[model samples]
Target: MIASGCDCEIFEAGPGRVVRRARDGRSLEREAAVMRHARRHGFPAPEVLDADGPDILMERLEGPSLMEEVASTPGQAAEHGRLLASLLRRLSGVPAPGWLQAAPGGPGNRLLHLDLHPANVLMTPDGPRVIDWANAGRGAPGADVACTWLVLATAPAGPSLEGWRDGVLAAFLEGVDAAAARRHLPAVADRRRADEHISAVEKAEISAFVARETALT
Candidate 1:
């Protein structure tokens, strides 16, 4: 296996291809559809070759995830943050198809990657390519930005990683709509709080972070 996540494992399938298989045996049709839609709109998403049941065959991305890059070179956190912000901005411009479900909080025509974060971005020779469309849907762009902020701010991290999160977040907010993020933060926090994969400690931190951020805004 090339890598593994909470719900999936990536395995090299052949030259330029990899298979992402869900651990819990869920269909990947929706994820594939979202990726194809994003790609059709010129968004940077991995090319989906096939999706069947729990497995999605996609073009193999070369190089490290944005998170891994930041972890190794802390000095580049700000640069990566800007890149992330730009990616979010680009994604927000894509019009959502009717088949895509609406996310919590508000109705919008924009596409949203509810799980977007550094770990989901791959820094390739061509550019940054976004991966993992499982949580993608339709929502206000700000809500998506708020989701990214919440993840960066409250995800459980080690000492070194924790130290750099603030810097990355600050840089990212500078490039995006900070006010929008603040506006939608409460709803995002509530959604994250109910996530089954989130730890209790992280959930508590998310609540505190949301409260402080919203109050300041």
Candidate 2:
């Protein structure tokens, strides 16, 4: 077994296969379906080999995560940002599958990766491949982008890593409309607040940010 998270445990099944067993069987099934859909649409995602009950067997992608690279290779911050932005653009352009539904108060038509962050992206030989589809669904592109921005902005980092984060955010927003993303911040923050994974301190920070941004708008 390689990694274990709150929801799932990942194991290397063999040279080409990886097994993901989720505590919640339904969520694992949903994740497998989402990956299959993404792959069908030419998105960079794992190929699902089998999905039985709570276990999902998928193609093993080898490489460091984008988060690892960003923390270790500060000089490549801009490049990573560009790559992430491109991936977001591509994901946003893909039409959501019929079974997907938007989160409450979010746009219902656009495909959204609600939890897309550096840690969820793997730097593969082919390129960066997005993983962890647990929070993906149909929603506003701005909401998705805003969620990413929030994650980047609020992530705990040391003094040394702060500059890298800033560079990445700067590059990410180079061609993006800051206003549009900012507009969704409050909504995204609200959604994030309800997540069990968020700590009380983090929730308080997000809530305060939302209140401040709401007043300005």
Candidate 3:
């Protein structure tokens, strides 16, 4: 296995492919469909090859994740942040299909990657490609940005990354509608709080972030 996340494992399938299988026996068909749809709309999502039951075969993305890049070279945090902002902008341009589920904040006609963070982005030879579409859905573009903001603002990090997080987040929000992102922050906060995978420490960080941000309003 190449890597494993909270509920899925990634395995090398061949020379240039990988298989992502869920651990809980849930079907990955919807996730596969979402990736294909995003790709069809010209987004930089990984190309899906085949999907059945709990496994999805996809083109292997080669490179370190954006998080790795920033962590290794802290000076590049702002630049990578802008890159993430650009990716989010590109995704916002893609029209959401009606069959997709609505995102947490509310319903809208834009593709929302509810977990778009540095770790989910692969800095590939071609460019940055977004991965892990399990939480994707349709919603207002601001909702997607809000989710990223909440994560960047609160997710647990090592001492090395803790200080740089704000730099990356600031650069990312500079290009997007900060007001709109703040508008959706509360909804995103609630969603994160209820996620079963969130650790207690992370939940406390999230709550603290929410209180700080909300007080400024």
TM-score of candidate 2 versus the correct structure, residues matched by position: 0.92
Q: lDDT score, residue 201, model 1?
A: 90
- lDDT for each residue of candidate 1 in 7-101, tens digit (9 for 90 to 100): 89999999999999999999998999999999999999999999899999999999898998888999888998898899999999999989999
Off by over 4 Å in 2: 25-27, 158-160, 212-216
User: Which residue runs does candidate 3 get wrong by more than 4 Å?
Assistant: none
The alpha-carbon deviation from the true structure for residue 167 of candidate 1, after best TM-score superposition, in angstroms, is 1.5
TM-score of each: 0.96, 0.92, 0.96
lDDT scores of the candidates, listed in order? 0.90, 0.82, 0.90
Candidate number that wins on TM-score, 2 or 3: 3
For residues 1-217, write the lDDT of model 3, one tens digit per residue.
9899898999999999999999998999999999999999999999999999999999999999999898899988889889888988999999998999888777689989989999999989999999999889899999999998898888888976867787898899898887878878889999889999899989998888888887887
TM-score of 3: 0.96
lDDT of 3: 0.90
Q: Rank order by TM-score, top first? A: 3, 1, 2
Worst 10 residues of 1 by lDDT: 157-166
